[model samples]
Target chain A: MADPAANGNTDSGGSRIGRVPAGYWLAGAFLLVVPSFASNFVMYQIFGWSFILGMISLSLMFLAGYGGMFSLAQMTVAGLAGYVVAICGTSAITDISQNWPWYINIPAALLIAAIFATIVGWLAVRTEGIYTIMITLAVASAFFYFTRQNYVLFNGFSGFNGIFPPQLFGVDWRNPIAFYYLALFWAVFWYLAVLYVSRSPMGLALQGIRDNPRRMAALGFDVTLHRVAAYTFAAFPAAIGGILLTWQSAQISPGTAGIGPVIDILVIAVIGGLRHPIGPFVGAFVYVILKSFSIDILVALGMAGERFQLLIGLGFLAIVFWSPDGLLGLWAKLRDLNRRDPLIGRLVRRL
Target chain B: MKTRTLLAVLAATFLTATAHAQTLKVGALATLEGTYTALGEDGMRGLRLALSQANNMAGGREIEIIVAGTDASPDSAVRAARKVVEQDGVELLIGPLSGSEGIALRDYSKTQPHVTFINGISGAQETTFVDPSENFFRFNMDGAQWSAGLGEYIYNVKGYETIATIAEDYSFTYTQVLGLALGYCAAGGEITERIWVPLGTKDFASIIAALPDDVDALYLGLGGGDAVNFLNQYQQAGGDAQLVGGTIMVDGTVLSSKGDAKNALIGVPSSGPQADTWDDPNWQAFVKAYQDEFPPDQRFPSPSLMATGYYNATTAAVSCLNEVGGDLSDGQAAFRSCLSNLVLDAPNGEIKLDGNRQAIGTNFISEVVELEDGTLATQLVKIVPNVNQTLGIDPETFAGFGVPGRDVPECKSSY
Candidate 1:
């Protein structure tokens, strides 16, 4: 049987980077210097949003890819962190916000989100396959409704606006350049961490459990403990992304973590490719670019701007139809073709 | 061949750049997606009509409007606003149809001092009341201002001494309820119960059962689908309580809703920014212009309140451009000054800004009545002129009532 879950995954963390790939070096350099030429909108709205979204989706990838848990509550965990920040930190809703310092609220938000995720994991882990998705979706839906209805804390339908980033190092952290670097740093940190963890013994054990839970249990591995731990680990990146997202928008509402966004994070993870660490970021960049420019594209094509959703849906279907593993899988197939058919590959390369 | 192609490309780029410099760029934002799509379409129609009246020329420059759409989420609104301001480089932004979107944009306006923001149908009280932005101007009345004269009309004319309220629980509806409760209680009226329902509620069985039977009327502060749903279920349950409609409950959006339940809305007294059948010449002209501008199939018989709000905002922007000769240089200081003091003779009424740049305009108390063609429309009963954000109460006294919420502005009479 083809191991679809483990497809394209290679190496353990102990196998260190033997001769770092040229693509990685080039990508790193390009990202570091992007702000020099990019406009404030590109840096702040496009790249900054992508990095935050990528980090959240990366948390999902870490679960579905390494631990075989496809939890939809990742976005809810992120949203919970954002809500904690708005409630604890300063916001325009003077009556509701406590106006605590960022130092107190930031850590508090992370801890609360992590704890919430742990509880959700404990409940969701008992279910397998499709049931897990249904359970996570239910949790996410409950959070959305609760936040919408509870005015004393969550501020009901309107929620909270004007929740700006605190000034750090004499810089408005929400400034386009500053926010881009902030989001980029967190995204990269989580990316490397997930990559390293996936190769570790813990990651292998989780993968074994994913393949056969009974076999892993028979082999003396604590399958449930590892699955729950994966959720806790995933929450950190999602929480950090949530904090950055709230800071970027300067507001948090029930719609921020509503059913729409919860599904969007999953769509982002799956489209980028679940087999590797870089897949989610690739998917996120595509998604953000499409969202930002779809109006112009539709208008240029002589179509109504409201049809952008149709375009996105079509693109999503095309990608999924041709490459079941996602864009990364498509790229891998192209590379394999180049190696297998030397004459045709050389002629195409020459052109 | 390559040299000729390159030269042609350079020439095309130069021609486009020069053409762009001769035109003025403005951004128009609306919730073109999600639940408020119909409202947003009307807002855009209002904007286009105003632009067409100006012949798309303001000051000495040709006006160029860049349109952006949002899903009514604050995040999407901000991103759309940022793209137009930072990427497309618009001098002024007119937009954002939802309440929360307005509050978020008001904060965003603080970050962009050079770009002026004109409110478009966002009736959130806090948008201008709290930490108001200097460059942001709202030409439409807030939710509280829309509730003017409704309480007195209900108590004195309708002989409703005791009433209960059923409102969608949100900031905007809270402001409306606060306005009604304060006005009614001050006029020797009493409120027996207040039931706050979440938006998008489908069932009204329990709510109808829980309503106090002794109350003379039930003040409905719900809007959109919630209003339609409640009315349908309430009718099925054989509800006979006299209805006092909120500004939105009797709006064309709900009146035009498909169902026989809307018949329950007939003779229901309500108050809002404008009445559909007002005989005022300006309003008649506006209605004619709106009908002439778009096909009958595409628009309602009367322009929606959202359409009126955007029309007023666009008129202010366009006239200011004329006053300043379209010169928006030096951080738009001259334009801002002209806008702040300029009185707008809106189709509904004469609108002027208060100290916070929020509109102190007119309100109309009306009752829903079916027209000759069997279409429902609000007929004018009373006109409340120059109603301010504070609902005519003294500033200190109004502040004492605190921000609008579940129990805010206390329903009981102080006397």
Candidate 2:
């Protein structure tokens, strides 16, 4: 009989192995500590944003990479969480709201996001791959304009702003570093937890279904249940990321859930080498860094930075043509080279 | 053969590189290369003139005014914002050319706290209302603030009993209608109905299908491309609606983008610091200088609103910088304090940033008239200065004014 633990993930030696490769945890730990030595601006701004976005992309990885499903609504899901935070609780303030304490509003917002995600998942999962994408895309588009016109709900175009984070542990997490650590803390916890879940029997069943849903169903696996669970699991990360985004920017609007941004999540996952737990982080890192410098390169070429997409388009095309596996895959090849170079190792020892 | 061809191309390109690639980086993220690219280019020209006038030196900085024309997409706006913040090394930012862009660009603002962000007419009201870090400020009147003069003019002054809200469906457009309705409602008037169409909607038949004939006045929140369609269709469909627009409804630049729709629109636009306010000889001379530097089509009439926004927006940022001069560490407190306590002279008149850090400035109510040039024009008739008066509320206060929020809808549009 097969083991049910770690979602019943076992090696030939009969020892349980985690869903995430061990390297992923090491990388997460490495990233967590880098902020300590980094500049406040780097730690607070660039690194913090990367972590926030990484977490969001992590949810996408959970859905698309592991579960073999692609839903555009994860970004929308996060945005919904952001809107709830801005409009519901203590963060709701005098602008989006006049009353509400932090404790009451945040959980309410999170719960609302999860419930909405559950409903969306149930409806979206009713259809297969491409249909799920289309349905979620439709939902996202609906949310985008709905927030714009429904004055009573979204306050029309003005959108809710000034969504303040709680002074958790009596520390003002609004500080860039504080926010950074908060993001890092959440990211690490999820990394560990998801790693655990992916190796579990449920994870294996989900993977089995991904390979051949009909066979998995005949084998007595609840295909529908597994898909729903994947989406629900994905929603937890997306919701946290969205809530963090709201707190980070202190605002929420239709712009957060717009189509362009929704699609970019796919781009991030594709670019990060969508093979493992570390892929989302790698993708987000490159995306942030690419954006950080794209405008300057454009300006140097006498092109307006505002129109930098013309240049970025070329870079994206190059990446797709040259390395289909993305930056992480390229890094792996380079690491392989380093391993094979005896002279390099001898030189390293001499140094 | 392919590699040889590549080498030849690389060599050819390398030889043509500029000797001194000294780029003057003027940072802008206007909607210039997409649906609203024309408007974005117009904003770029506005800043170009300002840069040329200053010889590209302001607060002792020389920039090439590097542009990051957005496709009027929020994600594109962020890409543009990143360009300014990281690549162009822009001391400040000027636009995203739309309300949604403004909202997202402001989120990017936190990522580059040292770089000041100014709204380029992304008048969603929420941009600088409450979530505004000291880094982000809008010079131009917000969507709600622009319509500050409308309610009184349409209802109290013109004595219209009921009005219908017809606008493009989006936050900025929707909020403008709401602001007008709020103003009208506060003064004991009712909005007959609210009809919203998509931003690029070419036909208004569906939305126009619902207008009750009882409305004596029509409140227009339609803008740019959608405005032209709305007006063109409203007239063709024989909707007997008298127009009272939110600022850009009758703007010359907006008309330029629509090509022929200039002839169909006639009304009082209530966005402030308009060109007619330059009726004073001193300001007229500035106009004459502006005219001499650029062709007629290049001249922006609504500099009354836009330029004032840029000036006030920059001033707000600088005030914070001045207080925290040479001290980047505690810049946050000084910025918040500077913003909270500022009362500056904006070209639109005196602008005071309320407790919410939103500016209260004079708004103009201008009539659309035929100029001698035979072009449709907005002639200044009245100015409603400081529409907010004493109401110092932020976006946080503003959004929660009525009801609760629902689940933000998921994206439904396919790329």
Candidate 3:
């Protein structure tokens, strides 16, 4: 056996790199060089959208998995950030948008998203179990209606378009290759951050509060504060994803954070397995792929393209029914089953 | 012998290259999901009808159309557009069936100068009015233009001096309301109230209660499900206000809905791109073709405005293609020139683009009438020709009212 310290549990920098599993290293390498081989559509529309969604869903995972809160307002928060960026930055709605610089608008978006999430957390964390879901959903619906109606700031139903990313480094950041890297960077950063925080003291306290609020409170932890702080922490990734999403489409509208997307973010988190940091990304990939290609798939099956929602609904039901903990849980179960059967285990290991 | 063999190979290569270059790819986009699915389907049907009329050939090039769907969101519409453009590599794109989607497509059209984009059914004024794209062409009237003649018709013909307005709180509705308000107010009519409701509001009890009892008529700007819902609820509440409608309020989509509510819509004055019962030979022929093209179960009794918009746009595209002879070379300069200058004798009326590539087209003033078949349809009242985006007002004065909103085009004695 190896010492825990040598395993990089207590090591820093170079040693930590050495301790990373080969699978993670391979994934990292593949993700880094994805733009080299991927088509512009794949890089920009498929993977770029997946990473942005994954990051937002990651926020949901952080809340539900670590804090025992199934908040549907994560997308709403992301949308708020997008709205902030569009309103603060230049957009086609010159009458509405303040037209601030990107550097200013981006940070402002993050700050505003964090503050909004904090408030949502404050209201939501007071409730337990299904009440929290209901509250977040209500918040999401309210924001949708507000944005769709308030033309002064949100520009009503036709929200801000022509809101492109800053041309930093003499490059249009929304260019497929550049956008791919930008999304990848944020997705990986948040994933690693979530992983790190999951093992940290605050994460532990939040988990403890989730599992047993009374006991954690007895143990001298401020339950509400930790929960709200978790929301603040999760908001950063979601806000970044929102900013990227707005840039990707070069637009932001109420539909971006409508009730459909709010539920979709929750569905992505749950379907990917909220049990691990990597689950949301996996789920986001599945969703993005399905969303992008389901029409073709349906058409191939000699079905109408409009039945995509039905297909997605069926897939969601099947995954929820078969794997209560999602794809990751199903994978673990298969691995365990393979371990019990030596022949299958050998085949799996060889593959 | 060697020289003859080389000449044969060169000839074969030339023939194959010519054949390969003779195929034109087109991308058709619509909202096949969410609230506007039916509209998108009709839009596609209209496009297909136009394509079939052209025998799917334009400018000597065989047309290949790829269809994509959106949920009426700008982002999804843009993504779908990108997929068709970047992946399918289409040289032409048509559609995007909602207001915001049109604005988004207009922006996207700027980046893709090579691909010719024709407007689908989206009627937002800003799509072409504000920072209009060079490559994007709209062959259908915007929402404001659709309201041409309705305001005057209401004030002069119906003689309703005081009116209250209720509309879906969106840009399209805002523009439509602005159009009617501008004309009605200028003609010495007064608007008592303008109530703006969110797009998908199910409950109309409160809205019904809020309607001023003194207004001569209630001008409803709601569309699709909202129109049906509001009419249903209003009838249920037993409210007896004389009803006027925005373009979409009295569309076949809502009028044909099976309910006692639509009965209240009878005699309701409205204006739009098409009147279902227009006596014009071209319109009747177009309706016959539309009805024949799709089975009764798959379509409305008459073609909806959405179908008309797409049909007009597709007709323009096909005609322009024939004019340019399928030659998209020189960055499609010739094709675009043909498009800009072409006056399409559309099924609805003559359509020609203005300086900004926006359509200056005809509008139909009509009122709801129950046909002998017990289906609701619009009967023609008047036809307003050459209605521009500015609704015949000076561009400077029109812009001075600012972009359409709740309180925009403030009702006054005259402009």
Candidate 4:
């Protein structure tokens, strides 16, 4: 299949010239206006979660798609940020939080998360392929246990609750519209950042490393450093997402970094199409919608509520089988098929 | 013309009165699809049974239940609660079957000030005792309150002088261990060894090996599949330390799955109500109602502790609603006051919330016994009446007692 990026026909120069595409502007406008039409539930559950989870999975996507590194530690990085936020902010479980101002807490959480990710990435980048996955998984598992058992730090398994989003500008940041816009700003910022990086010279170098790491290393591209950089870059957004997630849920616990959720982010990235910047958000939307409604749907169909996971697994499996690149890849394939047959292509485009 | 005008006014008033009988929306949140699924299902069943008995009417208004799955995480529970409140527009919320979820929901209750939240089997002490919410009420006891008399039961009745404690390393387990240790130590017993296992520790070989041979009993505070794994592994290892602790150790699922291993629990006193063995008419009726709703099948033969907890909470909520005549237009404050003053005739006995909105009710130390049918059952042997959130300790001292842990309560010979 052709590269989705190539089909866009935009170059680094286009981005450098600050020539924003019409579609991009239209999408931005749509997102900005979503708060007006969307209900508070939609804003919180659908958009809020999609943006946060998308940012987390996008980190994974950037690493996997560009650097050829599949780190299971993206959610772990997010969890680290959440823990930092809780520990630095007021919470129900502990008095350990310094109760610092939001300005201090948010940045400190992100910095610590990024540092943690960098250290993990530095250790993990030494390995390749499945070994990279295994090492990251091990790190994730270790973090989960560490947080769960270390009562003085992570407050044991109950974790920290009442970690509210900072009330800023004399407004509660968690209020539906405010929270939505806050999430939107970060999500869009990261999405564009990922897009720009993917087209930059460094991004091209990382992609080269992804395609042929030995060759890139032999050619003096410093492959390990690039991979580590990818991880560090990815951690920033993930950490922000983690902070947002902590604010969204008003709590942080071992479950946030559990093995199940760590894998779910990978699935979301893959299901959305890891090759593209927009894939994670697309996948997150699908996942969040299904997760929110699958139980009710199954119960309505006279099935047990627990079968919701089964349905989700089946859906993921079907998508993977149908198109290795996920839903976006499938869409790309259909579009390619249409282009082959102009008559059908016109009809398809019209539809 | 005067007669026609009078008739029109009467018609308008009658229409307005009929419209006032709106359906009352209530949300039921539980970990309906994860590790604690059995507990969540049992809770839902108990809730539905209570609602059925109430004819689905509360305060002269038809009740509409909106169920959301919590997935047993604090994050998911908060999200589920939000969906139920913001999306489904439920006036009241019940649920979130785990400790962390309870704390999260309590925090969330502050955000939704007008929404009344009744606890659904979440035993985390912090949900009420540590940081109580005015809009939140728990009719069921916290983990510590549930294990009120177990220590005494083990020391005085079971003759366990020095016992070892093995519990899941979490706030809930910590609270459970504290409860057991308090009663045991107060009765002149000792906890010689304390083993805190991480939540998902499947292999108990090392943990079993760590158990001191000198202890009279090994109190087990693990729950669900973890409990099942620990018990099976302990038995397989030929470890014969008498097991006793909290409700989770001898839950219905654990009993049936343990098979011949179930014998080890016989005469071992633990916490929680045992449906099959409780002789109280109210409990029997509740069991009958549950069985009628969910007949004896491959799933459940009798109601579990989760069921009883939800049933009691729902019963309390409905009773309060009945008293208020379904008028919450005055908002959660009116309902909060009503709940504060209300004393519920729960199946276990009278359940009344103390100053902190935590239940002060009967806490049973039930003995594991083989029923006539050869099924394992927990039979209530002792009742600690009016077991409060403070566990009989003064609030200030109890607050300073620190969070339950491997080392807390400073074991003494007497209370």
Model 4 alpha-carbon miss at residue B35, Å:
2.7
Q: What DockQ does candidate 4 have relative to the true complex?
A: 0.28
**Once model 1 is optimally superposed onto the true structure by TM-score, how far is the C-alpha of residue A45 displaced, in angstroms?**
1.0
TM-score of every prediction relative to native = 0.92, 0.73, 0.92, 0.92
What interface RMSD does candidate 3 have? Answer: 15.7
Ranking by DockQ: 1, 4, 3, 2
Candidate 2: give the TM-score of chain A: 0.85
> lDDT score, residue A211, model 2?
77
* lDDT (Cα, 0-100) at B269 in candidate 2: 43
lDDT of 1 by residue, B184-286 (tens): 8877899888889976677888998898898899999987777888999998999988999999899887898888999999999999999999999999999
> Candidate 3's residue-wise lDDT over B1-415, tens digit each?
1222332343233121112466898889988887677778888889889999999999898998778899878888899999888766788899878887888899899898989999898888888998899999999888889998888889999999999999988778988998898889888899988999977778999999989999898999998888888988998898999999999898877887786888998999999999999888999999999999999998989999888888888888888899888889898999999999999898899999999899998999999999998999999999898999998888988888887778987999776
Error of 3 at A84 (Å): 2.1
lDDT of 3 by residue, A49-162 (tens): 989999999999999998999999999999999999999999877887898998899999999999999999999999998999999999999999889878678888878887
lDDT of 1 at B199: 66
Error of 3 at A106 (Å): 2.6
Worst 10 residues of 1 chain B by lDDT: B10-19
What DockQ does each prediction reach against the true complex? 0.34, 0.07, 0.27, 0.28
Worst 10 residues of 2 chain A by lDDT: A1-10
Identify the superior model by DockQ, candidate 1 or candidate 4. Answer: 1
Off by over 4 Å in 1: A1-18, A94-96, A339-351, B1-19, B202-209
Worst 10 residues of 4 chain B by lDDT: B11-20
